[model samples]
Target: MRFFILILLFCCTFKGFSGDFSGTLNGAFTVHILLGTQEKAFNFGVSIFGTSTYKSTSVEGGININISPFFQKYGVYQGNFAGSMEFFGLIGYGKNANLLGSNVGLTRHTAFYDYTKTHNFFYGAGLVAVLNQATGNLKKFQNKQGGLILRFSDKQNSVAFNMVNDVNARPFSKSGTDKGNTARALISYTTIKNDELFGVGIGLDMFTPEADYGVAPHSHINSEEDTRLVLVNTKPYDDLFHLNLFSSFVYQNDDISFDGRFGVDNYKLGALVQNIIHDNFGLYPRFSWPVTQKGRFYSLLDFNVPFNTNFNE
Candidate 1:
């Protein structure tokens, strides 16, 4: 992890010194320490996320260290309509779901062209690498996969499609018996309201049972297909207080799947308090209420405090 971080830092430093660079950095760093309830039990965790843009490049790294040691790092390089193309890389390291079995590592690399100048379409291909350490009854697994990404967006609507297949791979389940590939399609639409937006979206995700592909090997439950619908409102407020609203419906083969940290779906509301305390500090709070299912409906009230720093040439 440290080696990879150093490599990213070196890229920034080397590029800055190689040319007459003029770049600006702007973004945020958030520290989240919160306590809540789930499944009728108390829970607490802490995490930190930092995301910033340096000119045409954007980098983000985040980790959760309180309950689970989950880490994600990503970088994107945007390009103009020239010989250069947009590139992206993402890496994730963590334990599998249920905190059992073995550790898992994931890496993805993609390069695409930006066609918004002519039309609202972008197409690309990517490679995925999965590494799972031996644990429980499962053997060590290593696999290399490839996929295609197709996206289209216009003023009021957007759609994305992804299909992945294993080129050469090993079994990904603990029993070494499961296999399959995956595909997903998501479509969404939004209407402009002043500077804010209101949107509705639907997603369909499918995993063919014998797919040798190792996407999410840790959480590899026997999922035939999953679908979801969501409604969203962005920047619903015009004052110093910032707010957003979301409501979702999840349809899954598991028969008992829903949204949130817990399994209960609700009208989710979140707020941000910023700028009054300091230029780079803010607090965020979120709440949810149950609407469809009953059982011990959970209510959580936790806050996040963030501080930001930027460096540019």
Candidate 2:
């Protein structure tokens, strides 16, 4: 278990996308902190939240503020609107410089008229932080950017599928012309035998249009994009043991993206596994070597705690 935890820490330094989101709804609130370097593999977003519902209605939101190598503040919200429908939004702002700002967006979801089962589609679009490269991790979150998301999920049986798409901007990227876009898809299956007895999930994420940090006043975006795919899963062998796995697919170009071009070219396959000894508290021991890319490999101990209850659980 410690081995896989070390690999997650070592891999995070190479290059990837991460978002820490949390918020509240109605009389209760929720929080989620998601950090990942691979495309879709081994991505766990924490949710510590609460909410109150009465008179045939509901509403809620979640956000998280993370202090890391770079300053970041992000959030996500969802609830009911009109009647038999739902609404959601994602927004945030961050600055490493001596500047401050604000931003906002909206998300919506409506369910099918199936009183016994939940069948619905989801869409999200909101403002996001456009970092300026100079900003360090110690800076506070600022609301000055916009982002959007769209997703659909339905649960009637033990198997369910979810697909999500999100896009944001980076003001420092090539004079702020290059927009960063991300796409994700996840399919999850639960067992009826024990509910938590055994379960598994698969996920994917792709990053396109390489984002740039304009170092020069006249810098412009260099057209380029890198792609990644991740596979994540969780299964319980017994009442006291659980098995987890994280894998990835990556592609980029180096030589072609040189001399003012998108300098990214490579390919990689990364996988790791862990055995949970105590739910949120567990050990992961794993290893990986980037193929066709120079991404580094390292190992670090991992610690996870629920600020509230486990949303995934």
List model 1 lDDT by residue over 1-313, tens digit each: 3432532353345344434322222222323322323212111222222222333333323222222111210001211111101111222221111110000111111101111222222122222222222222111222223344333334323333333333443332332311221222333332223322233344332211232233222221111222222112122110111111222222111111112222221221110111121224332111111122222333222233323233432
lDDT of each: 0.24, 0.21
For candidate 2, the 10 contiguous residues with the lowest summed lDDT are: 96-105
Off by over 4 Å in 2: 1-46, 50-60, 69-181, 190-199, 207-303, 307-313
Q: Which digits, one per residue and each the tens of the lDDT, describe model 2 over residues 1-313?
A: 2322232233223223233322122111212222322111111222111221222221122222222231121111111111101112221222101000000111111011112323322222222222222122201111122233322223322333434333233432333221122233434443212111123445443222222222212221111222222111111101111111222211112111000001111223222111111123432211111233443321111122222322222
* Model 1 misplaced regions, further than 4 Å: 1-134, 138-144, 155-158, 169-313
**Candidate 1 weakest lDDT stretch, 10 residues:** 96-105
Best by lDDT, which number?
1
**How much is 180 displaced in model 1, in angstroms?**
6.6
